[model samples]
Target: MKLLIQNLREYLRADFHPRLYLATAAWLGLLITLNYTFDLEDVYIDSLRGSWKRPVLYILLYTTVYYVAMGLWTYYHHRPDLWRNRRFWLHTGVGWVAYGFYAGFYGYNRWSEQLLDGQIYLFAYYCLSNLHSLVTLVLPLYLYYRFFDNGAEHFYGLKPKRDGLTVYALLLLIMVPLIAFASFQPHFLDFYPTYKDTTANEFLGVPEWVTALVYELCYGWDFVPTELLFRGFMVIGLSRITAVDKNQSGVILPMVVAYASIHFGKPLGETLSSVLGGYLLGVLALSTQSIWGGLLIHLSIAWLMDGAAFVQQWAQQPAGLTP
Candidate 1:
């Protein structure tokens, strides 16, 4: 514990920029306030999926504004060289394109037909459909990394350290109750577990429990791509292009804000909380140089919360009944 504290102190001393930190806080606070005031999440989701035209326009405008701001940020740090750097442009292109493809996958799934019939087939389809992060995000980012850095091991926080794992595991243990406590809230139950259809009796003659187990595993696996993209690619990969000093946390700000923005579709409290959580995880990934810890905490919290919800629902059922 002392070592963990000491490491965190060192991280703070090296990576925490007071002004940038304040800027991130203020920016996220304002965005959250406006989000609740205007209910912009609904608008944002509608704009993204309902129509092809709105989605395209939103992507174009959002990406343009994002890159322009990023260019200005790079300039502010006196790293104008990044603007002309082929590697940086390539990274930027791949990142946005991957995100677009991921979104497209979800949108397609939403609009597509239920052609597959059996419960097992449908369940598998649902799980495999989440591969947008793997297929589009991780793969392309890795290829890009290999192309540029000659297959560096630490490209996206893949190389884990013993001390880092210990610290993050302890941190994950500490978050157990926080997740449980959050599960009691009505709002939390509504969104958590993210898997709604647990009432299926069987799939391919397999029992419902077996199918549920498979579903939960896949559900947990879904977060792998999330960790890869936000913590691994965004924090680790993009940090090279944006940070003036690779040792500092300046590059983490953009990723943090963007991460928070993605949570806009969630409940207000969770959305607001994601800003701090996202930033901390990003910093942890940066400090430890591994997403394994982030993945552990993320997957644990997610699965536990889902379990809590399932238990609560079960308890509410009649004595002889089953979900």
Candidate 2:
């Protein structure tokens, strides 16, 4: 912990550019949230099944705006310097990877008729989901470049260290019980009252591997974007706003709130789980300075939980198989 503080100090001392990057991102996010709250007029739901649209356009538009706003804000704020740095490419590349993971998988699911079918609602959900992904990827890169890249001190007093083994061990320990519980007592945990009992085979009509891949591509992909938004972007962005010396507690506040708010309509148990999960991810992001770790964990959990449901359903089929 002492070493972490020392490293953070070194990173922050190197570069301290208080541009509109963080503020712009926050404002855009606020705009979308507010729009959703007030202009609920645009919302659309399927008539028969009451599903949202396959790919919610409003949501996508909002997300696109947010990403464009952040990019433009960053480019304008640090034009000459950012142009000169090769790290810009690295940052952009990472952002694209994150985006691809989000859009490709989600898009596939949207195409496969697995997602909500109400056009407006679907659009909103997709947009928000993608926005979350974009924030997660870009926010950290922004912080790393703005502060840590130049050996500057961080406000959160966090230092990035690569302790792969420790991370694996922690992840394993945390996940083992969850998996066990889900297997034996799936009813004990219900994050969303609207939960669907979807199975890979039933949904995709294929073998285990193919069904798993499809499921992962569609549902599992959203995990990355979700983590990126709450844990990656919100956490780091808030840290920058508050400054590091304010204490670790302050640093994680935004992340926790954002994480919980994202699940506003979810069940109490789910919301509670989200709070705990968000905090855990925030800690991991802060400790490692790598959103990738959180993303991996998020994706893994999603896959396991969703996959388990599929497996269970498959086991109960008349032929012990999916359609």
Candidate 3:
């Protein structure tokens, strides 16, 4: 018990790192958890299709709000150098561009399908499929570049290292529970319900493989931007505001908290899992100075889980499943 306490203390005071990201994450997590638990209907998916204007506007609003808040915090609390890194701007710009591409491409495709075929399910499938793809493919690479390769040495004051075995082991350990919980807990809301619904239909006149392939193309593109904005941009940006030393545990805390909060609308178990998962990912990034490792593991687990769920649902359906 004494040793455990000491370790806990050490983890908290281990380094000069930012806590703002973690704090924001925690707040977001709490908000999501509360909304989920209470069945709050305030959260709405930006389901506007057709025009790029609405989607672009929404993205701009979210990014601007996030940057403004972060900028203010940095201005008041820390020196200008911390917030004025040129690499930060470049990374952010690239990330936004990625986000725009994803939203525009996926959104337009879905709208076109809906307009031409009047297939609401296709539109839904596109959204979910795209989300899953993006989370799996693009997010990790963006994270790798932004957090690990781009500014790791400068901010963390540490050299880059790579250990594939360690990363794989850590990823496996973290993902095991996420998989178990997702499988067993029916009460927990699946993040991509529309996609799940569409995929469950085995006989929609479209081959399953073809549907999956198309979904992957759009989804993969979108996944990159999401990772950049949430994990890459948010985590790295907040690091500037909090200014926690990278050598110690403080650096990991904020990232963990922020990561967790992003999954707020999930079940308690899922929410907690995300927090732990975020910590593990952060640790992986810190140790290896690479997001690729983390992203690969993340994408693998996500695809596996989604595929499993789709298969399970399809198997359970009666002979004629059409939706």
Candidate 4:
């Protein structure tokens, strides 16, 4: 952890620009404010649900928002070469497309599929929702790695690293209390323990824990592709196009802004926290040249949040509160 902190401090000392950082913060704040005030993301996505046009529209929306932030970074950093760089285009293009499919991939009415009614329907809904990242982000990006980016970047940081893992474990431990505190907030409780409102265990003739385990596992697994894409591809993979040393490379901010845009539809506090979280993870992933540590920490906090929500609900059961 000390090493990580030193690396981050050094990197910031070398790269930090007060005006640029503040401008990027304002840009991100404006985007978030506009989206929330107008309900733009929800309105756009919900209206296009179930249509092939959904992802298409999302590509344009995400790309515009992302690049404008990147363009802002470029203007202040004065990286005129970035406009001429082919890999920048490649990273932005492929990334926006992958993100488009993933974010636009809400569950839809089955046009020809078998109808799964009752608790089974809700179970299937959560199951597919959590695991869609495998199809939308992981598979496409892996293909990009195998073909276009073969032998570069440890396959977008998919390879594991054992060093400094103890720090990641300690970070996860620290998040437990924070997550527990969040579980008490009305807004946080509303969206957490996402496996609620279902009794599909009886439908499957198994204990409730069975379905809960499956949902939680899939929920946690979604972060695998998420970390792989944002920190791995956007930060690490995108860095491959540059000639600067990793510490001096100008990648984390753009990725941080782009990553935060995806959280526009989430709770306001959650969306806001994503900026800080994404920036820290981007720095750590670049410093380590591996997404494993960030992935471990990201996935652990997520599971801990759900676990806190679950324990809170259980504790309330004896207080005359209903599940």
Q: Which candidate number would show the highest lDDT if scored against the true structure?
A: 4
Error of 4 at 68 (Å): 1.5
Models sorted by TM-score, best on top: 4, 1, 3, 2
List model 4 lDDT by residue over 1-323, tens digit each.
Answer: 78768878977986788998998888888888899999987887658888888888788877887788778767877787888988778876898899888877764235112467665887877777777787778889888887887548578887888766776777677777777778999888888877775888888999888999998898889888888888888888888775366766678887787788887777788888788788877887887778999888888888888888898788878766665
Tens digits of per-residue lDDT for model 3, 216-308: 555544544444444444454334434455433233553454445444445566667776667655555544444555555666666666655
When superposed on Cα atoms, how far off is each prediction in RMSD? 3.4, 11.1, 7.2, 2.3
Model 2 poorest ten-residue lDDT run: 41-50
State which candidate, 1 or 4, has the greater TM-score.
4
TM-score of each: 0.82, 0.48, 0.58, 0.92
Point out where model 4 deviates above 4 Å: 106-119, 151-153, 318-323
Better by lDDT, candidate 4 or 3: 4
For 1-323, candidate 2 gives per-residue lDDT tens digits of 34434534643343223454355446545644654565422333112122333124323433444345435544543433433546444443343444333333343234334454443343334334434444444555455558644533442223344544356347656876766566445553343112243343444456546534543465565565565555554455344443424332233533444454444343334545775566555655655656666666676666666556655655657974444
lDDT digits (tens) for residues 82-129 of candidate 1 = 678786667666666666556544443542335444444456556666
Clash pairs (backbone) in predicted model 4: none
lDDT of 2 at 313: 56
Among these predictions, the greatest TM-score belongs to 4
Badly placed stretches (over 4 Å) of model 1 are 1-4, 14-17, 44-85, 107-115, 118-125, 149-151, 198-200, 241-245
lDDT of each structure?
0.66, 0.46, 0.50, 0.80
C-alpha lDDT of residue 190 in model 3: 53
Better of 2 and 3 by lDDT: 3
Residue-level lDDT for 110 in candidate 4 = 54
- Measured by TM-score, how close is model 1 to the native structure? 0.82
TM-score of 3: 0.58
